[model samples]
Target: MLVRIITGIIGITAAAFVIQTGGVVFAGFTLLLMLLAWFEYVRAFSERGMGIALVTGFIALAAMWYAAWQKPELLALACPLIVLVMLLESVLMRGSTSIMDALASGAGLIYIGFPFTCLLQLRGMLPETVFSTEISSFTFGCAFVWIMFIGTWASDTFAYFTGTAIGRHKLCPSISPNKTIEGFMGSVIGTTAVVAGLGYYLNLPLQEMAVLGLLIAIFATLGDLVESVAKRYVGIKDSGNIIPGHGGVWDRFDSVLFTAPLVFYFVQFVNLLGK
Candidate 1:
């Protein structure tokens, strides 16, 4: 427990630093994480006798990250191009591969690449002028990303303690047996409170922050469960053991991966409704 807490604090500090210095630093860090996550993901699948295009998939991953970092709006164009490349590679390896192989490869790209890219998108939030409403402190800053991170962290922390204290009913006994219904509710309530406090401090939209907190709690739990399912299917406890006490990059960022896109679009919806 001590080791895990220490490692987690260090990891969070590093991530916060990168987020605060949002530019090449954050992009490079995210790119590294995306690649490592892809490697861990591919390793898991390959261990199960699933064939994937390694070089081609890496290229696609790099291209997609580049698109996200450099020209986010071109993501629509980049995605189809990636699929086309995957199919082309499948065709070239016709005797040894099928469309399924291409799809599996592409699926990894979408799963890891697209969501990791959302870090960049969330960091570069649309300007208030884009919505034509300068009502509150809705600027293109680190508040949204910080809210997502802190909210998810608070949710997980609250869930852990709550489950340890008085957890009774199982939430998902199959995928994650340790989780409990009491803990899940604790996470939702705890995250909402934390994010609401942050919103008040930062002069952000409190209503949106509260809603986003609930979304974070739910999706963060689902994300952790989904990773648990993946690892259980592969018969592995951790993804890569890259971090000292935490499992891997994927393990650390799993919840953020799920919540990032949700928060991104949810903020847009809030802005739209306001206008």
Candidate 2:
């Protein structure tokens, strides 16, 4: 428990620093995480004899992210191009790499690459001019990203304690035996309270923040469960031993990966509605 608490604090501190940095530094941080996540991902799936080409995978991953960052319009082309590249490689290798294995490699690119790129999008997305009069667009963008991070982290943290204390009924016993219905409720309530408070304090839209908080809790739980299922299937306890008492980059960012896209589009929808 102590180790978990200490790790959480350290992690949060580092996260705060980079979030505030919010430029090339944050981009570099996100790239480093995506690379670590890719490493863990390939290593985990290797158990099933999926021999993903590491060099090709990295190139495709970097290309996809570049499209997302600099050329949003090119993403449609980039995705299919990646799949085509994977398929070609698999065909060339014939007996060495199955088509299923090739598809899984593409799936990993989408699963890890797209969501990680959304973090950049959310951080860089500027708000409407009306709202920007009060708060700088840069500051507002940073706050939105903060809400995403905090909402997911709070949901996961409270769920654990709440489940341990008053958990009776199982939520998903097969995927994660420790999860409980009570804990799920706790996550929803706790995430709402914390995020609403943050939203109000930040002069953000309280109503939207409240709704986003609920969405984050729901999706964050689902995200954790999805990763848990993958790990269970892969016969691994943790994704990697990178982060002490917390598993790995994949484990730490799983909930954020799920919530990042949610918060990004939610805020954009809000901007549209306001306009």
Candidate 3:
């Protein structure tokens, strides 16, 4: 418990620092994170003796993330380019590649690439490019990303303690036997409370915060379950042992993978509707 708590604090501090900087600093940090996460993901597959085009996938992942950051409008073309590269790689190695291997490679890119790209896009939602002085500071955009992180962490923490204490019914026996329905409820309530409380400081409407919090909670749980399923399929317990107590980047940011994109679009939708 001590180790886990310490690691959590360090992680949160690092995240806050990068978020506040909010530009190449954050983008560079996220890119490094994506690389580590991609490595851990491929390493997990490699453990099962699965063959994939690591070089090509990494290139595509980096390219897509760059596009999302520098040119949000290019995402439409970037995604198809990734698939095309994956297919081309498969064909080029036809004699050695199996259909399952090819499929896994594609899935791996989408799983790791898309969500991380969404994070870049979310961070890039400032009034202008990172160089612009129109806003003078990244107060709003930074706060949005921070809240997404806080809400996700709150849900996971609450669910862990709640489930540990009095959890009864299994949430998903096959994928994650330890998760409980009670924990799920605790996660939702905890996330909502935290977001709503922070709303005032963030200068966001309480009602909007409530809805965002609920959505984050629900999607974060789904993200955890989906990751559990992937790990189970790969026959591994934790994604990696990079962090002493937190497992890996994937293990830590799985919830963010789902929640970031959802919140980004939701915020966009709300703004459009309000206007």
Candidate topping lDDT: 2
Residue-level lDDT of model 2, residues 1-275, one tens digit each, is 79888998998899988987888778888888888898898999998777876777788878877776788789779888888888887889988888888988888878888888888877777643223335343366687788788899899989999999999999999999999999999999999988988877766667877888888999999889988988998899889978889889999998877898888888877752344
What does the lDDT read for residue 74 in candidate 2? 92
lDDT of 2 at 194: 87
Candidate 2, residue 74: how far the Cα is off, in Å: 1.7
Per-candidate TM equals 0.90, 0.91, 0.92
Q: How accurate locally is residue 168 in candidate 3, as Cα lDDT from 0 to 100?
A: 99
Q: Runs in model 3 with CA error above 4 Å?
A: 128-138, 272-275
Model 1, residue 64: what's the lDDT? 84
Cα lDDT tens digits for candidate 3, 1-275: 89988987887788878888878999998888888888888888887788877777778888888888888789889887777767776678888776667788877788778888887778767544222234334455666787788899898988999999989999999989999999999999999989988775545678888888899999999999989988998899899888878899899888888998887888777852233
lDDT of 1 at 35: 90
Q: Model 3: clashing residue pairs?
A: none
What lDDT tens digits, residue by residue, belong to model 1 across residues 139-188?
45466777778888998999999998999999999999999999999999
**List of clashing residue pairs for candidate 2:** none
- Model 2 poorest ten-residue lDDT run: 128-137
Q: Candidate 3: TM-score?
A: 0.92
